[model samples]
Target: MEWVLLVIAGLCSGIIGALVGLGGGVILVPVIVYLGSVGLLDGITPQTVVGLSVIMMIFTGLSSTIAYMKKKTVDFKSGWIFFAGSAPGTILGAFVNRGLDLPSFQLYFGIMMVFLSLLLLIRKHLKPVHWFVKNGRKTTFEDGTGTYVYGYPIWFALLLTFGIGFSSGLFGIGGGSMLVPAMLLLFLFPPHVAVGTSMFMVFLSALVNSVTHISLGNVPWLYTIPVIPAAYIGAKIGAYLNHRLNSDSLVIVLQIVLLLLGVRSILDGIM
Candidate 1:
């Protein structure tokens, strides 16, 4: 039964991660913590939770990237550029994660969740930065709707993804929550391209993060058995749906869920 629940959690996280390019750690971390709180799981700590979440993200990112690749949605050049910044940031964040206790970790993670939810809420209302679009490296993408051109300054992108990667390593949330919004609002990336490229970056960052956590003995190998495969399958499903469905409604739902989870985490930390 416990394994079943873990599998379900992984599936849900993978689906949502691939669907929105958030890498599903947002969902998985809270669920794991909740289960631990309820005595359904044992030996839960901030580091272990984050470690497990990053490990699961490996499969989530890889599976989704493959699916998005088939659709020609991934921007590999930008993805590589983003990775250059994220890799070092992830290593730094993993080191930082070792210093956090449960309450502090919960508090900070809750704050992050709330911020990401709000970012998504206001993302559509945000406009692309004129400077980035005008002066940055330009690229074009075409979909059924039309042709879209978008770009960002290389220096700014590096700085931004470094922060994203740091957050991913610290919280195991895959950094997509921040990256997708930044891409869409500041860089003028098409929505599909933003998500696809975000996953690619997530994959690379997760690889760095997982390695660091593994070296630190943070991952609980037994707990990861069910999650990895389940998340992989779920990511495939989500990528398939991304091609056919309107994700605006799903984003709204995810925002609400994240908001609720954020509040719960904050209260848990406080009490």
Candidate 2:
């Protein structure tokens, strides 16, 4: 009976995560905490939930990557750079994460999630004011965030990507929520491709973070096994929907809703 509830919650989480390009940790973390309070998790701590969420996200990444790969949306070059830096950082974060109490962990996680949520809401209103096609390269659409005619300066892009990687390292997320927006507003990556490629980058980041968490004795295999398959399935569903919905408005709306949900999740964790 309890397993049924867990599975259902996991499925809903997967669908939301896939649609929004998040690793689902924000949503899952809150649920785990709530479950713990209700004695639904059978004594699972929030830290265990974080660890298991990272492990489950691996399957989520695989499914989303496969869906995006079909359309050739992956940008491996930029992705690897972020992954390289994120790997070591995630290891360091896991060690640091171990010392914090439950409330402190939840508080910090909540704050980060709330900030990300607001960023998503802001991205919805930002217009794509320019398109860059240089050397016959892939079309790059830049939102109106930078004054440079060539879009955001190269240094700025690097910094934003580094920030995304840093968040991934700190939280065991793929940084997809942040990456997708950065690519859209800063790098001018097309929405579809940005989402897909972000998943790839997230995949690498998740792999690194997951391994690091496991090594640090943080992973909770018990609940993870139940959640991952459902997450993969939800990713497939989201990928299918992504191809079906071809409007900027829809994407914006979806992102906004996700942002609000992220906010809600964070608030729940904190309170």
Candidate 3:
């Protein structure tokens, strides 16, 4: 029965991932609470839910990361650089979630979701800016080649990455909700490329965190295993759909979905 529920969680999350480049944290975390809280598992608690949730994210991220990589949409340099901070931050977040209360977690998680979704909506409107050097020359944000600053050094990017990683690890997500918007807003990454790169970071970073989750007995493989194939398929389809749908409508839908999921999780956790 637990296995069945986990499989459902994975499938649902995969479908959402296909659409929004997330593993469906807003959706899955709530459902996890609702389903597992009703005497579904022995010794049920918020920490247990969080632990298992983070564990599942590792696999979910791994599945989608492959698809994003195949599409050639990943931004490795930025992701790797960010991982320097994110990797450590994620481990720290896991510890925080471990010690937190249920209602507070739910409440904070929903608030964060609302915040992140709105930020994403706003990011769609931001225009790219030209770069300037300390030398005070009217230099473009791009290199002399007129391309966007892919390898352009930005010390602030690491700070942003660390923040994103912390949020992801704390919430048991890939942080696409946070990452996609941040990358788009700050780095001015193309949306498609940002989604792909975010997925890559999710996979690698979550994979590392999964080891810790397992060591602490927080992950539930029975539930996480079934969703693997579906998550992969969903990621590819989402990337394909990126070309088909008008991005505005898609993002709007994603925003609503995440908001509702976050709110629902909070409500469920409260009582």
Candidate 4:
């Protein structure tokens, strides 16, 4: 039964993660923590939860990246550039995660979740920054929708992704909560390209972050046994759905879920 629940959670996480480029940790971490809190699972700590979540993200990112690559949506150059900053930040965040207790971790994670939810809620109304579009590197992408041009300053992108990576390593929520929106609202990236590129960066950053967690003995290998394959399969399904579905509705649904989860987590931390 416990394994079944874990598999279900992984599938949900992977689908949501791939659909929106959230890397699925946003869903998985809270589920694991909640299960542990209710005594359905054992030996759950902030470190271990984060560790397991990131490990699962490795598969989520890889599976989604492959699917996006087939559609030619991934911006490989930007992914690499973003990764340059994210790698070091991920290492640093893993170290910081070791210092947090469960209550503190929950509090911070809840706040982050709420912030990300609100960011997404407001993202559609926001416009791309003029300075970023005018002065930064420029590229064009063409699809059935039409031709779109977008770019970001290399230096700013590095700095932004570093913060995203730090958050990922700390919370195991994958940086896509922040990265995807930034690409859409601040950097002028097309929606599909933003999600695809974000997943690519997620894959690379998770690789670095997971290694750091493994070395710190934070990973619960047994817990990850069911999650990996489930997440991988779900990612493939999500990638397929991305092309067919109107993501605006999904984003609205996701916003509500995150907001509710964030409030619950915050209350849990306080109590």
lDDT for each residue of candidate 3 in 28-76, tens digit (9 for 90 to 100): 6767777756767565555665656555555556666666667666777
**Residue 125 lDDT, candidate 4, scale 0-100:** 84
- The weakest ten consecutive residues by lDDT in model 4 span 124-133
On residues 143-167, what C-alpha lDDT tens digit does candidate 2 reach at each position? 4443222234444445566666656
**What TM-score fits each model?**
0.98, 0.81, 0.81, 0.99
lDDT per residue as tens, model 4, 158-250: 999999999999999989989998998888899999999999999999999999999999999998999999999999998889999998899
Error of 4 at 199 (Å): 0.4
- 24 Cα displacement, candidate 3 (Å): 3.1
Q: How much lDDT does each candidate structure score?
A: 0.93, 0.66, 0.65, 0.94
The CA lDDT at 204 in model 1 is: 87
Q: Once superposed on the true structure, which residue ranges of model 1 sit more than 4 Å away at CA?
A: none
Top-down TM-score ranking: 4, 1, 3, 2
Provide the lowest-lDDT 10-residue window in model 1.
124-133
Tens digits of per-residue lDDT, candidate 1, 1-271, equal 8899999999999999999899999999999989988999899999999999999999999999999999999999999999999999999999999999988888899999999899989988876787898999999898898999899889999999999999999999999999999998888898899999999999988999999999999999999999999999999999999988999999999999999999889988888
* Model 4 spans with C-alpha error above 4 angstroms: none
Clashing pairs in 2: 141-188
If both were scored by lDDT, which would come out higher, candidate 1 or candidate 2? 1
